[model samples]
Every structure is written in C-alpha cells, then in structure tokens.
Target: EEVYASQPDGFVDPDNPNHVYKLKKALYRLKQALRVWYDMLSSFLLSQDFSKGLQISQNPRGIFINQLKYALESLKKYGFESCDPVDTPMVEKSKLDEDKEGKTIDPSHYHGMIGTLLYLTASRP
Candidate 1:
C-alpha cells in the first residue's frame, strides 16, 4: 500500500517497452522512503503488541543501548579468564607512558589492545 510511481519506462528493454512495472517497495532516492518504512514497521510491531524500547538518543529514533554482552565478550577475547579481576582498569600509582626501554612489540598489536581498552572505557567509566 506504500508503493510509489517511478519514472516510466526509462530503461525498459525494447522488446518489452510496452510494459510498465509497478514499484512495490521503497527506493533510496525517495525523500520519504525511510520515514515511511520506519512508520510501517513500527505500526506493525505495535499492532502485534510490541511496545517501543527506550530510545538512547534523539538524533536517530528507536535506538536501544546495552553493554553487558560486549564487556563479557571483550573479557573472554583478551584472555582475562583466569586473571584476577581488578577493581580499577588502571592502578592508582601506575604509569601508562610509552616504555622507551622496553622490548618493542608489533605496533599493530599494541594499537589493537589500546583500541579495545579505549572502547571498554565507554561502558566501564
């Protein structure tokens, strides 16, 4: 029921030039397509008694936020399984400066570790 008319026969095959295809779906070019699709999906969910979940932001509607699963997976992936859990990510007196005298590990691997820790801060902080 949300179908719209598109430009007529612009690229139709010459043998089938007489045929006019009716569009039954939304297209990216249409300004209202996203809104219409969202409204339609929301309406269907509501009709089935599924209430909208809490919105975490206003710029985009209907977004849900949760971090438990991500944190658990990160802990597993980083081999923290047997290690003792620390109350704080960083120690009170610990310094995190680049160790100029320490044996250098692969820059890519170090950067990857730093990236994961940085992302964890979003939830842990």
Candidate 2:
C-alpha cells in the first residue's frame, strides 16, 4: 500500500529527485528494498555532505549496504551461503525470544552468530 502511494513507474524528477519526489519513501514494499533504500539514503547523505559512515564509490542508487563484500564473506565463512534468502528481515510484528526449555546451545556459537549479523548490518540500526 505504501509503495503504491508514489509517482508512476520509473519516475524520477531529475530536477530535484530528493526534495520533490522523495524516491526513498516509496521503496518500502519493493523487492530488495532494504538494499535499495540503504544505497539511496547513503548516497543522498553523501551528496548533501553529511558524514557518518564509510564512503565507497558506487553506481547510481547503489543501495543496500548489506551487500558489502564482508557480508558475503561472512556468509561463506559461516557456511550460510546456501541459506534461503528472504525478502523481509523478519515476519511482520513477530516476537523472538530465547526458549528456556529448549536444548541449550553453546554461548560461543550464539555469540558468533550475533557477531556475524552485526557485521552484516553494517550499522544498519
């Protein structure tokens, strides 16, 4: 619904894409939107001379910081390269928590997963 409330297809007001169209807001429901949005926002910030994170040379709308080489490397490092990729980060409004009664896992492994995800986020939060 949100994604539909925007300009028509392939719409980009070259005159002032950011201020007039806000192409960023319309990407929510898109495939690989997380990546696209990230790329656009980062580029926008850089264009505006706003500094916060690493600056990498990129293609237009090269969104999605999660696509970093390190992220892929981490996936291969952790043997998750073949894992099914999901469009959404998590199910909508889903609750996640530790299962106290479930079989215990090694804390180190848990920490490792956390570490890997943190790297993947690339300051996502």
Candidate 3:
C-alpha cells in the first residue's frame, strides 16, 4: 500500500504547504511496515550465511532488543563483579595511564579481558 504523510506541524515547508512526504523506508507502527522491515532484515542476515534465531519481541510499547543477560554473564565469567563500574569499557580514565613504578599487569589477564570485549563487540555491533 502507498503511504504519504504531511510534514509535522513545525516541519512543514512554507513554500509547499500542500506537499506530503512519500515513505521509502519502513516505519514501525505504520500499517504493515513492521513486516516489511523484518523481511529486509532477515534476508540480509541470511545473505551473511547466518542461521536463524535473532532475538526480537513486540509488546504494547514497541520492539525490544537487548544483550543485558549476555553482558552480565560475561562480567561474571571474567570475575568483574567486584570491580567498580567505570564509564569507559575497560577501566576508568585516570587508571588507564601506564605506571612505571607499579607492578605490571598479567598478560593472560589482559588477553582474556580484551578477547571477551572483542567477542562481545563482534556480536553486538
């Protein structure tokens, strides 16, 4: 079905007030646009040679997507439950500097943390 909508109240063009915007991209909650969107996304996933099971759900509010469970599991696996929550990914900004006088961090510990971050970014990005 063809869909056209007038510009929003404040966004309407002064010179062409009668013109309406024609939708090219699927907009969720706009008729069957959600179905069209899923078709495009699933086809792209298939083209990447990936299997099924993309987690997504619909509710009264809207679509929901998150990796909080996976993130929590990863933190627990890496023994980060005791670590202070930092704004940065690996560590706080001040602690990032190299300390010549301090004991060097274990290479294996660094490797595991970095590897975990890489794997998470690969899937989540």
**Candidate with the greatest TM-score versus the true structure:** 3
In the order shown, the candidates' Cα RMSDs to the true structure are 11.0, 17.9, 13.5
Clash number for model 1?
Answer: 0
lDDT of 2 by residue, 25-60 (tens): 545666758877888898999799654443366578
Candidate 3 per-residue lDDT, tens place, 1-125, comes to 77887899999899999999998876778867888978889899879965452356789999976666666766887788778866756644555657789997789988988887886688772
Candidate 1 lDDT by residue in tens digits, 1-120 = 546453464576677666555776767868767887899999999899665533344345555565555665656766775777669876689767987889967888777777877876
Angstrom error of the Cα, residue 3, model 1: value is 2.5
- lDDT of the candidates, in the order given: 0.67, 0.66, 0.77
Off by over 4 Å in 2: 1-55, 58-67, 87-104, 122-125
Error of 3 at 125 (Å): 6.0
Error of 3 at 19 (Å): 67
Candidate achieving the largest lDDT: 3
CA displacement after TM-score superposition, residue 23 of candidate 1 (Å): 1.2
TM-score of each: 0.38, 0.34, 0.38
Give the range of the ten consecutive residues with the poorest summed lDDT in model 2. Answer: 18-27
TM-score preference between candidates 1 and 3, better one:
3
